[model samples]
Target chain A: MPSLKDVKTKIGGVKKTSQITKAMNMVAAAKLRGAQSKMEAFRPYAEQFHAAMASLSAGTGGARFPLMEVREVKKVELVVVTSDRGLCGSFNANILKVANRAVAELEAAGKKVSLVCVGKKARNFFRKSGKMRKDYIDIMGTFQMFNARAIAQDAAANFLSGEADEVRLIYGRFHSVALQRPEQTTILPIKPIEGEAGGAAAPASQAVYIYEPSQEEIMEVLLPMFLNVMVYHSMLEVSASEHAARMTAMDNATRACKDIINNLTLIYNKTRQAGITSELMDIVGGAEALKG
Target chain B: MAALIQLEIVTPKGAVLSEQVEMVTAPGYAGVFGVLANHAPLLSTIKIGNLVYKKDGRDDIVMVSGGFCEVSNNKVTFLVESAERGSDIDVDRALRAKERAEKRLAEAMAQKEKIDRVRAEAALQRALARLKAAGKM
Candidate 1:
C-alpha cells in the first residue's frame, strides 16, 4: 500500500490527467462537428458530379482520352490518404494497413507499385519504403481546394505519361461519428459507373443532340475535372474521419481516466480510514497501559 | 401547362440553388440562351456572367462563373465553379472590387513589369457581374 501522501499525490495527478483528457474530448467534439458539416456539404457535389459524369459520357461508349484507356497492369499507383495527427484511434493505422496490403498485393501480382501519400501519417509510415512518388504532408488539418487539384494533376500526369498503368485511391470513408471504414476506389480509365440509370441511356441519346462545343472537347476538360473532384472528395473524407476518430479516442481516454480516478479515490479513502483506525487504537492501547 | 424544370446550381463548394422553375437564361459557352421545360438532352459550358431565372412570377439573378450545364428529362443542372445570388451579393464589396480593378488596369499602363491582363480583365468582369446582380450597376 502506498503512503497517504503518495496516494494523495497520485490522485491529484490523475485528476489533472482526467481534466486534460476531458478538455481534449470537448475540442475533438467541436472539430468533428465542423468537419462533419463540411463533409455533408460536399456529398451532393460528389453525387452530382458522378451522376453528371455518367450522363455526359453516356453518349459515347466512354471518352477516348488516355485517362479512359485500360492498359495492361504493369505499374500501379496508390493515392493513399491518412490523418496528419495521431491519437485518432486506429484510423491512420487502418489506412496504412490497407495501403500496405494493397502495395504488397500489387507487387505479388508481378506489378511495380508507387505511392502518393496525402497526409503526414502516410508520409511517415511509408518513409522507410522507397516507393513514394509524391508525399503531400500536413495538408489534412488545413485543407485547400488546390491541394486536391494538385494531387489530381499529379495522378493524371502519371497515368497519362505511362508511368502508372493503373491508379487507385485508398482512404478512410466517413460513414458516421462512430464508424469510419477504409475503402479503395479505382480512379483511372474514367469508366462509366454501373447501376446508374443515366449512364446506360447515354449511348442511345448521343445521336440526336446538339453539342454546343464538340463532344470530344467537353470530354477533354470534364474527365480531368472529375478526377480532381474525386481527389477532393477523398481529402474531405479524411478530414471528417480524422476528427471523428479523435473524438472517440479522446472520449474513451476520458472514460478510462475517470475509472482510474474513481479507483484511486476509493483506495485513498480506505487508506485514510485505516490510518485513522490505527492511530485511534494506538492511543487507546497506550492509555490502557498507562492506567494498568 | 408544361412541367416545371428542376434547376440546380452547384459549385465546388456545394449546391447554391435547387428549385423547380419556369424558365432559366444563362450565358453559355457560345452565347446566352434560355431554356424552358422539355428541352432536349443538351450539355453546354457556362460562361462567367449573370444567370436569370423566373419562378413564381418573379425573376431572380445569379452571378455564375465558368462551369458546365446539362439538361435532361426536365432537370437542368448548372455545375459551376462559383455562384452568388443577387440578394447575397454585397453591393459595397462589388463596388469596391470594381474600383480596385479599374485602378489596377490604369496602374498597369504606367508599371514597368508586365501586368496580368487576363486576371485584371476577369476581376473587372466579375465585379461588373456582381454589381449588376445586386442592381447597383
Candidate 2:
C-alpha cells in the first residue's frame, strides 16, 4: 500500500502526463486538417490521370506502347510507404503486415523480392527482417513531390534496366480517420484492359489528327511522366493517412490519460482522508488517557 | 456545330482547371497546336510551354511543364507534371527562378556534366514557360 504522500505525488505526475497528451492531441488535430485537404485537392488529378491512361490502354493503338508489354515475372520490387514516426497506432503495423505477406507470397512462388522502403518506420521494420535492398530515410519527413519523383525515377530505371521485372507499391490507402486500408498495386508493365476496341478503330465521325511528331516519340515521353505522377499521388495519400492516424491515436491517448488521472486523483483523496482520520483518532485516545 | 469542348489541366498536386471552353492551344513537342470542338481523338506529348484556352471569349494562359495531352469524346485533358495559371505566376519570383536556372545551366555546361546540364536545362525550360505564359517572353 502506498502512503498518502506517495499517492499524492503519483496523482500530480498523472495530471502532468494528461496535460501533455492533451496538448499533443490538439496539435495533431490541427495538422490533420491541413494534410486531409491536401489529399482531397490531389484526388481529382490522380483520378483523371488514371482514367485517361485506362482509356488510352483500351484503344487499339495502345499495343504500340512499350509500357503495355506484359512479361514473365522473375524479380519484383516492392515500394513500401509507412510513417516516419511510430506514435500513430497500427498505421505502420498494418502496412508492414501487408508488405510482409506480399514478400512471402512472391518468394514462395520462386520469385526474388526486393524492398524500397520510404519511411523511417518502414526502414527499421524491414532492416530488422534483413530483407530491404534500398532504404530512403532522408526523404520521408518532408513528403515532397520532387522526392517522390526521384524515387519513382529510380524504380523505373531499375525496371527498364531489367534489374526488376515488376514493381509494386504497398501503402495505406486513406479513406477517413476511422478507416485506413492497406493496398498493394502493380506499378509496372501497365496492365491493359481486356476486350477493348483498339485505338486503330478511331471513330469514323471524328476527324483524323495529324501527328507533327511520331507517335512512338510521344509515348516514350508520356510513359515516364505517368509513372512519376502516380508515385507523387501515392506519396500524398500516404502522408495524409499518417496525419489522420496520428490525430486519432493522440486523441484516444489523451482521453485515456485523463481517465487515469481521474482514477488516481480519487485514490489520492481516499488515502488522504484515511490518514487524517487515523491522526484524529490517536489524538482523542491520548486525551482520554490523560483524563483518566 | 461548335459545341463547347471540355478542357482539363491536371498536375500531380491536383486538377488545376476543368471547364468547358471554346478552344485550346497547347505547346506540342513538335510545335504549338490548336484544338477545336469535335476534334478527332488524339494523344500527343507536350513540351514545357504556355497553354492557352478561350472560355466565354476570355483568354486564359497556363504554364505547363512537359507531359502528355489526350483528346477523346470532345474532352481535352493535359496531364502535366506541374502547371501554374498565368494569373497566379509572380513575375519577380519567376524572373529570379529564370536567372537561377540560367546560371546553373552555364555552370553545368562549364563543368561538362551532361546529367546536371540536362536538369538545369529542364529548370530553365519550366521558368521560360512561366515567363511565356505571363507574356514577359
What lDDT does the true structure give each of the candidates? Answer: 0.85, 0.80
lDDT of 2 at A133: 77
**RMSDs, each prediction?**
4.0, 3.3
What's the lDDT for residue B101 in model 1? 86
User: TM-score (0 to 1) for chain A, all models?
Assistant: 0.94, 0.89
On residues A1-292, what C-alpha lDDT tens digit does candidate 1 reach at each position? Answer: 7898998898889889878878888898898888777777777777777776665666655447778898998999999999888988999999999999999888999999999999999999998899998999888766566688789988999999999988999999999989999999999966765536544556667666667787777777678888888888899898889888988998898888888889989999999999999999999999999999
- Give per-residue lDDT, candidate 2, residue A31: 73
Q: Docking category for candidate 2?
A: acceptable
Clashes per model (N, Cα, C within 3 A): 1, 5
DockQ of each: 0.46, 0.48
- Which whole-number lDDT from 0 to 100 does residue A236 have in model 2? 69
Enumerate residue pairs that collide in model 1.
A58-A202
